[model samples]
Target: MLPNEFSSSPARVSGMDVGLRSHMQRIYNRMTVGVLITALVSFYIGHNEELLRVIFGTPLKWVVMLAPLAIVMFGFNPARMSSGALRLSFIALSVLYGVSFGAIFAVYTGESIAKAFFVATSMFAGISIFGYTTKKDLSAMGSFAVMGMIGVLVLSLINIFVASSLMSNVIAGVGILAFGGMTAWETQRMKEMYSSRDNEEMASRMSWAAALNLYISFIAMFQYVLHFMGQRN
Candidate 1:
């Protein structure tokens, strides 16, 4: 949120200005592509009754639900892989997420889902813009958001055993607020990670990493919002 605290030569500052813009654009572009892929994959699966039944009706659903988490833990490592590899893995992760998310359509109407998507997009854009433009430091908020997310995760797991709809709904609303804050924090962190001095490869890797964070935040926000709008048959 604060202005450039990193002291640098005038040439370096100029380079950073241009490089940061380009790098940010790359991150957004990668993230957008991933989101499109996810939407397309989700729609295709959700709209086809046979495809949906085949995946969700059997033991395969466990693999679908767990695959994304496994991939995120191992596949997203920025240290071992190249930028191009990470970008590809990022798209793969989105597809996995989409497969898991297909069940939403079975539970909610398409119109409600569309409405929630727009609401999420609007919220994400505004929150990310504030992160990019604000003067106040969001690191504190980020820490709080992380804590809130952990609390929500724990409660959600508990609810799975308790089977309490009221608690589930409350967690969903809290999750939306937590992820909104996380979106801002992640955007700020991604921007701060940029440096003109880095090599193109490093910059690209960082962009993919940022994209991953933003993508997760956006998806989480959308899921939480959808719970509120979703209607039961």
Candidate 2:
């Protein structure tokens, strides 16, 4: 019996690993779709001068800018929401983000935007891979990063009125580091969260939640990277 149990252990462990990989893949696939949607929407709105002006140049810009945040804060309850509702919420958030980010085209040159995006993608991929593969626990680092992010958010809000270039640069520098840490932390957390026992709905909800976390981290990293690399028009 002892030999039989030992012989089966490897297969069980291998199955678990396969399940984890599949779960992570689903999370990544959802995130990729969200990123593509945001990119396409932003590109469309950015290229249209009249639409850009109508959205960003008018009082409606505030709504476009803050709607995603509002939805995230108030309506992103995956536990209570069905998978369909979660998907709709994710799409709406992505579209709102795209609308807000469309202003970047008016501010930064295309070459700089592309360069920053490439850098951000490379950094995110490397960091996430490390997190997924490393045996070390990053919960402490994640907590610290969350605190740093909150600080960054507060500073950013303050800088909106202060409008100091030095402070803005400082925020961007700190934000890049914070978001980079968050990418790794979130990846590790997602791996740990995966379980074969979860029902289909539960698994789907978890995937959406993980995707949202990674998506936010990636977008934040990209924006911070753009701040440093982007050439203003």
Candidate 3:
């Protein structure tokens, strides 16, 4: 009786598998779209020095830099935000990141930037695949990666004042490692988040939130990878 009650019927199991795949696909699609928006905006801003100066030259740049962090604060409270609000917040955050990251063009050669981008994409794909396919539980690794990320953020702030190029490079290197683990862990967690009982609105809000998580991980890894691989202009 217990075995019969606990087992899912074959059709039910098949339906569940299909639903899981569909949900996972939605998360990936959303994440991809967000990444493209960021890349395009970054490229556009990076090419126009005048616009870059106008935005980054003054105190207003603080808002550009801080806005992404602010969106992340909102993202942490996804339970309170509606799906539309969460989606708009993600878009705003991505554009803000692009604007802030325009400095990459000022410092790195185009060829090096392209090379770094290609390599980062390949690496990201591999890590994400591992996370999706692996049976190993990554929950602890996720916690550790988050701690590493906090350390990197704090060190990055300190290095800004210290003006140490070596330290900056070190930070970038560590950032790649930290965000690499984060990408895999985030993928696993996103997969684990699927619930058959969720309503459409709930699923969508969660999807937006998960997409933001993956988008952040991907962008951070790309930036750090580019920093280390890119040639100075």
Candidate 4:
């Protein structure tokens, strides 16, 4: 007998797979659009030192530093919010990330950034596809990725005070691995969490959660990869 959550009716699994596929597609599409927006904005602002200084200088420094974290808070919230609200949160997060990445364009050569972005894109697509199709459970990787992320964050915070170049590189390297794992793990997670019976509110909230996680992972990985090839001003 099927579990209560899956329904015990004559349709068996019913349209659950169909609905899940559509939901997953939306999540990926939303995340991809957000990444594109962030990249465009970041690339645009990267070339303009005047605008960069305006946004990143003075009191704005605090805002620029904290904005990504703030957007993440809204994006990850699973409080049964509306789809529009969820989507807006994702967009807000993406914009803040783009603004933060603007600094990279100033520091890195355009060619290097382009090369690294392409590499990251290829890697992201491969792993994300694996996550979507693999029948194996990724909950273990998800747990470990979370721990890896926390470690990376702690190391990064320490580097700010230590200002050690060695530690910075180590953190960047680990960041690539951590976020890469997260992208795959989160994709698998979304597949696992999906439910056809979930109302629009539930689906929206969960879908955004998945999309937001993937977005942040991609951005983090892209930045770290760029560091290796960046032309350091």
lDDT of 1: 0.87
lDDT of 1 by residue, 117-204 (tens): 9999999999999998898899998998898899899999899899998998889988988888998998888878885436878878
Give the CA lDDT, 0 to 100, for residue 46 in model 3.
93
| lDDT, candidate 4, 8-77, per-residue tens | 5536555677788899998888889999999988988888889898988778867977977976764446
Write down the worst ten-residue block by lDDT for model 4. 5-14
User: In model 4, what are the clashing residue pairs, if there are any?
Assistant: none
Better of 2 and 3 by lDDT: 2
Q: What's the lDDT for residue 34 in model 2?
A: 89
CA lDDT, candidate 2, residue 139: 92
Best first by lDDT, ranked: 2, 1, 3, 4
Order of models, best TM-score first:
2, 3, 1, 4
TM-score, candidate 4, is 0.89
Candidate 2 is scored at a TM of 0.97
Query: Which candidate's TM-score is highest?
Result: 2
Residue 79, candidate 3: how far off, in angstroms? 0.4
Q: Give the distance in Å from residue 221's predicted Cα in candidate 2 to where it truly belongs.
A: 0.3
Between candidates 3 and 4, the TM-score winner: 3
Worst 10 residues of 1 by lDDT: 1-10
Tell me model 2's lDDT, rounded to 2 decimals.
0.91
Tens digits of per-residue lDDT for model 3, 122-196: 998999999989999999889888988998999999998998989988889888888899989988887788863
